[model samples]
Target chain A: MVSRPVGFEQQASSGALGSVDLGPADLVPFDDRGLAYGDGLFETVLLRAGAPVLWEHHRARLALGCDRLGIPFPCQDALDATWQGDPTAELEVLKLILTRGSGGRGYAEPESITPRLLSRRTPFQPVVKRWQEGVRVRLCNLRLGHQPYLAGIKHLNRLENVLARREWRDASIAEGLLADSAGRVVEATSMNVFWQQAGALFTPPLDQCGVAGTLRAALIDQGAVTQAALPLGELSAVDQLWVANSVQGVWPVTTLFSTNGSRLQRWPLPASDPLQCLAHPLLGFA
Target chain B: MVSRPVGFEQQASSGALGSVDLGPADLVPFDDRGLAYGDGLFETVLLRAGAPVLWEHHRARLALGCDRLGIPFPCQDALDATWQGDPTAELEVLKLILTRGSGGRGYAEPESITPRLLSRRTPFQPVVKRWQEGVRVRLCNLRLGHQPYLAGIKHLNRLENVLARREWRDASIAEGLLADSAGRVVEATSMNVFWQQAGALFTPPLDQCGVAGTLRAALIDQGAVTQAALPLGELSAVDQLWVANSVQGVWPVTTLFSTNGSRLQRWPLPASDPLQCLAHPLLGFA
Candidate 1:
């Protein structure tokens, strides 16, 4: 497996519509609709053993987002071009951002869209301690706004997550839990959450709000997980809890805390780790 | 008086976060939270006589968004640097995007946020005919999602607006009205809408959804308008309807069409134009 600290390198190019002449510009325009209106979609995948983990899943999610956002998305060839680099980096991070290129000063889709494909590689980072020892997460005060039209797909309009993340600053709190405007628990700030009761997996449905994470999708489709509208007051009902994402894999929780730092539930482990025997090799220590 | 066809030109540079040494590279990193998560805010202002038309108002609104989004905003001097180029172009549009710069993946606020300030100039295209003889607008099938925390601030995350604008493709339709998910009439695709009734001005409250347009704010603060939770079925009761923004100033709506191409209401212009004595000079042609 690859291993290195995260160091970022960027490259950008124009695609599809042929209007933008990005010409090897390694930086994106500050005015990219992605920045100006969060008018884009992205996928971050882990590079293990010098190969992108879950590349197909990432692509599928990107396509889903493009269809939902009505963006003429970058196809497989364009996405493959972004995976350029030496295979020797061992472990690295890969990010792909597909923006509606540059648009006029409004929200309307441009008549001709040159989907801007921006990709970058960074040193792979793993929350090693949290993965092994377990992480402590707290509930956030900021509530996610419900938008079915814009929910599920991992599109760029993420100010809600930013605001929710800002509600707490303790690095000790590995993640923050966010609830929808209707008080249904959704996800951690950056990852999808799953709970295990009697050894069956359950996750919150993202139909109202929250990103339908690639890994979460895989688990659910594989029958490894089920959807449920978990409430904030029911944390104690879980036999175990975990939050996961592609880059960092699955991290079991030691405790889930309320907004005021009161312990709501505890999922202490046996002398052995949980996911070690459960998750796929790519998702945890094999 | 200034007039010209709208054309766009753009240039990007590094901002207060000297961490970025932007040169001929002319690109932002893919890891830029702006693209990754739409972690940014923006302002589009009218440049009349080579000056930003609601200069103070735009700045104030930007500041409000920065404070809300928690981005360390670029000051006035940084904003001024983005307004370079010509003084002779009859009119040009200026757009500024402030992002949380580059950061690690996910929604968490970066440990060090060097806000990036990106600005561009585009030729100003005034809707001359629409200004003279009011334009026809249609109601969009897409509804805006309500997020009270993000309401009123012009932060980036405008996917709803993009989707709503796509509901209609008729060139004859100058604009479209978007309501929140709760059926409260909010705004046009790109402008704040106001209706005149009994010689008093009323606009939908933006507390649930919609941008608090600079011109709308100006009119409200100047005691020229009042806020209401206008429902979709009540448009016919208004004496006059208008949509306004900083760049286009204001345009009276001669007709508003339903999503299915049905006429909803009509406002025929007087032999002597109405609003001649009502609208401020900055808003319309007297």
Candidate 2:
């Protein structure tokens, strides 16, 4: 087992020469469009034995974000070369950020663009406990804005998520679910949510808002989940609910509460769940 | 006259003591929450004789943003002390960015937040020509998302504006107007829009989406303009139109074009438009 500190973090920036370890004090340029306007996209991936899981999904989403935002996609070979991590680590978390670099000032992107790629790695603390014993979640008072142009991509303009996540500080509440302005259940603060009804899985359609999570995409691609508009009122009728992201795998929601701490719904931790059964092998969860 | 380069830029960071000049090569920390999640607020002010125009308005808006986002407001005295600029210059632009500072990795803000204040100054290029002879604008294909929670405040999640601004590259097209997903005309890429209808000034209500511009607020407060829903269908019926911002002053729209470069409406540039007449003195447009 790797002897790295539990919360130890390391960062690097990629250039023509490959990855260069960034000193703790090294900063992003003051003029970086990312800091100035949140003009960037980021992906969080689970790395097992230093190999990134769901890398293809992350790259595809990044490429989609680049296309939508008019930022150029970084070369795959360069990204692969720069993403090398500590081979000894059994489990690690890697976050990749791609920004429109520095544009001096203003909303208009510079005539010539140089996209910057920065990567950070940390030791992963598996959510095995939360997964085994279903986690509790709350509905956020914060309703997500519907912008189809920005929906589904993991971009840096994430104040909505930040706001939703900050609504509650109760340690018992593992996550907060968010809805769109129209009262449609959209997603959890950090993960895509899915519910089972009559032996069929349904996740909220993200055409209007929410990030299209990599694991969520994989589930949909495998015909395990279907996208539908799950309104807040309809959530009570669902059989089983689960939230999933690339890094944390799948977590079943045993209890749901309103923002006011009033209990909304409760479920028993089942002996077996289809989502867990399907995701455990892929997520390497014992 | 100050002989600085036309686009020469200078940046500084403020701490307890005062603002320290940041070298061109200096970067924002890679872990800054602003870079991570666009969890910040920015204000661009017009500096004349080393003093920010409408300083109170900018500060109030910043305070509002901080309060709404739950980011701690920096001490006002520190901000005033650090805002000292080049008094010799007749006109300059100051861009103030207040981020939630370094938060290591996630969206959850650090418990003890040290909000980072970054200031950038650039030479202001007055749009006197556009102001005098009304400018041309186009309707962008991109639509702003409707999120009442994030509406009105000028936060860092500005990809919509960036996307709208990049929709046109024509030098003659001075700006692009954006509408929410529901086809309601909101504002221009970087300015608040107002129009005259039957001799009364009206601007779009930002209660749903769009930045509540400082200048727009000033106009509304002065009873010169009223907040009303301006739909895309009503643009052709308006008598005259103008876009205003803190930095650029105001520019009357002489012509409006569809995204495909087709002219939708044209208006004669009056010898003395009421908006120009009213805004000239306030904006220092001779």
Candidate 3:
């Protein structure tokens, strides 16, 4: 095992001091592997009353990502200390980005890595309207490529999602649903998706592609959801559908549109979605 | 088309003041989309005697990537200015990174983007020995996922290459060959692969996946190479094999090993390889 650099520990602790503004302290070296090759992972945590909701889940996922990429996980004390902030805001968004640090030109990892953890806090923009009254989502023309090795972890290589999200600029369309190259349903642009069939909850299996979200994990752990392969063709037959993430709680998808902007499927307003009900409290949603 | 931001032009022109040191001027803001979501493209140009090799090919690829991603291409005047440097070094590596500048916290791009172009020049470490005497390579277990939309563009989402490069630490192994999920030969960890079959040169098609190397494009343009779907199983039947990129030129594969380190195929030293002979002068190799 490669030994962690002492300088990294010190730098990380101090850098984790957290930033409210994009000052000099918030700048990363231009050669950072994160920017050069997307060699990193990130977490977006919702801060309610200054406490990070589902902090443990975020931490665990980050650790998992670090392990998969072979980057040394930063000290937990440093992370906790960095996460500490004033309890003034009613709601905030804490974004944590962990990168393999700066490296010389090439794809090889540096002899000794100085992992950098950058944290920024911004006021959370509430999507209560979408959360209350379902959202309209469309099937993206872009299909996600399957790389099992990089699957499930929310790594920094997200050009696919960026391209997928760029498919729709219509304000009415809240999200774009992505499918694997094989036509299997994966996830939405920034959230995990779930559908109900015969009163059973099912979400796409992420072994091939797509991120395994924290909110989706909590539901599975609580026995409210099961992993299954949902083909794009099978979506129209599902009873109910909802999209969720750690910060956005759950937004029911009321309308599904084809790539050409014509509606393919529509569902009635979710009067009471058991899946959303089970997730709202955990995500700190009203 | 989105109107190009004036600040970006000013920033690009100034930021291109080539830096040999990582100073405050060389730092990228943490919120830059390149670091956040790998929303960027990059080019590694070889400088032999202070002149960039295959410059037009590199510029065209970067522009193609920007157009594909809907990022406003940086002004050509700014890019040309940024590329100017003190023509002193015998051999230098110039890396240009163009990112969809800083954005608010989300996958959806900001209403207006200020694209950032980062350039750095470093002394090139010539792999003369690897170039002279063919190098040994092995097949990587990590298969590249096929994303047609992202195929062929040398974008910043290169975690696959990073992971594949990390698979083997044995310095003796010059590079690792990667195959697509369908077991079709794609490329090496950091270079493009070409092999001779019945006296015809063939390289993998980049439509499904793989970075279409500028050097590879140059070779193809000259009719020295043709694109074909190469199955991994057919490597043993090939008469000659070589891996190449702009910076490293062409390195003939002396040995090919399986993922487990067992010899899968071997090729005799090229007493006179026409492909390498065709590529040597273009790559500034003796």
Highest TM-score: give the candidate number: 3
By lDDT: ranked, best first: 3, 2, 1
Question: Which residue window of length 10 is worst by lDDT in model 2 chain A?
Answer: A1-10
**Which structure is stronger by TM-score: 1 or 3?**
3
User: What TM-score results for chain B in every one of the models?
Assistant: 0.88, 0.90, 0.92
Q: Is candidate 2 or candidate 3 better by lDDT?
A: 3
TM-score of chain A of each: 0.88, 0.91, 0.92
Per-candidate RMSD, Å = 6.4, 5.7, 3.8
Q: For each predicted model, how many residue pairs clash, with residues at least 3 apart or on different chains?
A: 7, 2, 0
Q: Using DockQ, rank the candidates from best to worst.
A: 3, 2, 1
Clashing pairs in 3: none
lDDT of 2 by residue, B136-205 (tens): 9999999898888788998999999998888888889988999988899999999999999888999999
Q: What's the true lDDT of residue B130 in model 2?
A: 80
True lDDT of residue A211, candidate 1? 91
What TM-score does structure 2 among the candidates reach? 0.92
List the candidates' TM-scores in order.
Answer: 0.88, 0.92, 0.94
Q: Comparing candidate 2 with candidate 3, which one achieves the higher TM-score?
A: 3
